[model samples]
Target chain A: MKLFKDAGHLFRLAGVFLLGTLSFLAIRAFVVPHSFGQYGHYRGAAIAEIAAHPVHFAGHQTCETCHSDIAQTKSAGKHAQVNCEACHGPLAKHADDPSIDPGKPDVAVLCVRCHSASAARPKDFPQVDADQHSGGIPCTTCHQPHNPVIAAGGAK
Target chain B: MPGVEGFMYPNEISLYWSVLIVLYPFITGLVAGAFILASLERVFRVEAVRPTYRLALLTALAFLLVAPLPLQLHLGHPERSLEMYMTPHRTSAMAMFGFVYLWYLMAVLTVEIWLDYRADIVALSNSTTGWRRWLYRILTLGSQNVSERALHIDERVGWLITLIGIPSAFLLHGYVGFIFGSIKANPWWSSPLMPVVFIFSAMVSGIAAVMLLYMVLMRLRRQPIDMSCVDTIAQYLLYIFIIDFSLEMLDLIHRIYEADESFRSLDFMVHTRLWLSQVVLQICIGTLTPILLLFLVQVTKLSVPVRKRIYVVSGSLALIGIFAMRWNVVIGGQLFSKSFLGYTTYKMALATREGLLVSIALTILPLVILWVLVKLLPPWPEKRHAPLPAALAAD
Candidate 1:
């Protein structure tokens, strides 16, 4: 009788533990406040953070020192709004070595992050796609980096 | 003149009271329309509409509860939107909304529903135990007696409340339409027929909802549906849909006849940008199809199965069509540029908690409320054994 009672108590304890674990899992999956998606949800501050802390991502400035012409055009264009890490993903090893070249990331996916109509961006913004944008001109040719528009004064 | 650049579509209009403001009345119109249907049976003793009366009231309440959510979401500072009430600003049309909401919820609907169900609540309280017993008792409000006198008093009070509620319902939804109609800035929303159009369409949607719900509920319970009850509801739905569709056509006619300076741009928008939504979906699929189906069912003297199928299909169409109408009026109107030169597109994002997910949750919340309401009040009166129909037995 003592052994039977002990077994019953152990079963109840197991039931309680199982209930707790299930509840925790549900809350984590459905209700918890975790940031979501990479489209419009990416804050400008994250871009600024990447800009301010160049040492963290193999310093775009170091590349600028060696490759001035490409860097100048890139800095001037609208692509300036985006950080290299956002488009290329993490690049700690590639940043450390000058000899190893990391090829351009998937251009279609990167552009669609902002350009797609259904992408999680501004509501009033118009739909965009590579086909619609390609009028015998590449995105870089028309857009320039960080600056889509050219100012009156150049970097003379 | 050749060298000058002119804006095809202007961006000069202020979006102060925009699309969100327009939806407020559309939703309220549904609430009022549903409540008025409930009043037809509850107050006027319309035996044919008995099945729909309770369902109508609950539908009205459900829509009413969520009416302000869109407006709240639209406001730049939703938290500060409450300041309209605290300051008691007379010029602010939105200030009166809170008072209107409270009066309907507390002074009218709550009282009428309670009085209507007092006897049933008392009975349910006695039959049940545990939390349900306590719930029923509280709902009964300590009224244990189910005597004829008590019921008579309840019926009288319920009637009075319903009478008072009808005008409040009109004001709530009508005011919403009026706000849009009065906006002189947006020519698209500035028609005088806007309020009339809103109220009638609301009626169309409301009557259709009750009919669909009644059919579904009866089927679920394995009970035989009363064809007379359903026919009556369908008949009312047809009447309202005709008026609603006619008013919309009349507005279009008026716009064309007037041929204002904005006519070209507006016409282009209807033909090009909104052709699918306005011409195809709203007119052809939503309104015309349901109206035709309802007409065939009523005029043709069809078989039971055929009529039932038509009624369900028509009701479902009318509900969806009315929602599409609201969407077109709110979102579609905003897509065209004020300059009449260019049109901008709106892209709704997926996976956002504030977007479609919230709307779905709000829409389905009422089902939960209705289920609990049935569990508590049992909308229909209890069935008692009788040798003959009540009307014949009495005679």
Candidate 2:
């Protein structure tokens, strides 16, 4: 007790620090999700939450149902492996109602997303210097949408 | 693409980090630098800088409080930032920021400050009445004992905390640089020297800031400026500035000599897009001018008035140069495409979330907080010389 004589201030400060540390631990426990660190550092619930979102991309088979002509043409062209929704975006709603039009995809801007020349891309991958290849003209101007290599004139 | 030049990757058109991101390192650098300046007086026993010791600590505290604001503002979901504390990724350099920040703020800066100011707070609490008395009393944390023995304990503990603080300050800013330097993909930022460069530059800016603040505050208080303090601070600033500039040049010269694949791209960027900010503002007006001015004062037998003028000019420029350095690091790193064939432009918006307005406000916010802190704790030890407000004078 004699050692603590003038160090009462330190004891009081220590009490405050102890109170703060405990409070922080309590708050951290309360705020942290129950499933956090279940699998790793992130919340386990996040994976399931993300997976629960409604499916948006109607598969190639669904598009092949009605547009067999385009599918047949694409099957023979350079884009045989490419899916309808890959370029067109999510068309599940359009598939639900054919009358609901999925407007023309901007080939000018959209084509460069994949075709832009970069050293990182695979050597075999069909890439181009977008500016040099097309200038200001759209990709659809020279290449067909359904059969790109076939060159079916410009866009309608 | 409108503001962009050359052949930027489609994804590289828009810059991810904005001006707000630039402020993060700048603010934290100030905090680190200021604490280091304060530590010189405490641990290193540099009595010449004793005049600005408390001011430097308070400046560090003020800036440290605002360091995370820019990062929080930059986040799409500011609320999720708390998750960094809850579940920090071990492998991530950035996610570890929360822990580093907390440790520096809570353990080092605040503790050191409280220990150093414990006696003063106790004295103020007993001497004053009304709201101020209540405020100081609370700040004392019921530690009313300020006996000679207790004072000795405070001084000893304060010195020890500062000794710990020196390395902690280095870690704080060096970690900021690591966030950029460790990113292997970005050659502009990826360098082993990044952390060292950041630490030295931080010291330069921090010392300059405290010096300016001390001068201006003293002038405002109608007290005679501490010429010896400013002169010593200026000398240190010059030495540190030379180191910072040399580190930057070394990085540049190494890149030139090596002429790596990314070198051509980064070089072109420096000559073109970064011409104004990097070369003009940061190196010329901001860095070289201040260093030269400080050097001149050091070599020449200048009068007090002339030296004061030189200090003000150089200090302001030093702060500007440091801000420009941060800008170049953050913005310049993002400008060049990873493909090494393209460049993009940063279009800073106004009145938006991460806009120029917000950045300006965030920059000013720390100064405002410093003002309030100055009023509350009175970092000025010579309080009798300070010009008080009517109500405060009465109290």
Docking class of predicted structure 2: acceptable
What is each predicted model's overall lDDT from 0 to 1?
0.69, 0.88
Model 2: residues with Cα > 4 Å off, grouped in runs: A49-58, A62-74, A84-156, B384-395
Cα lDDT for residue A13, candidate 2? 76
**CA lDDT of B166 in candidate 2?**
91
Looking only at chain A, give the TM-score of model 2 against the true structure: 0.76
**Each prediction's DockQ against the real complex:** 0.02, 0.43
lDDT of 1 by residue, B1-395 (tens): 12112332333222233444445555676678788789877666667987778777877777777778767866657766654444345665667767677778777877677666666676778888999999987665554655554455455556788989888777776776776677788788898898778778888877887788788988998888889888888888898899999999999999999999888888987887678877888888889999999998877889888889999999888877887787777766676666666555544534443456556665676667777666566665343111222333353
DockQ of 2: 0.43
Give the winner by TM-score. 2
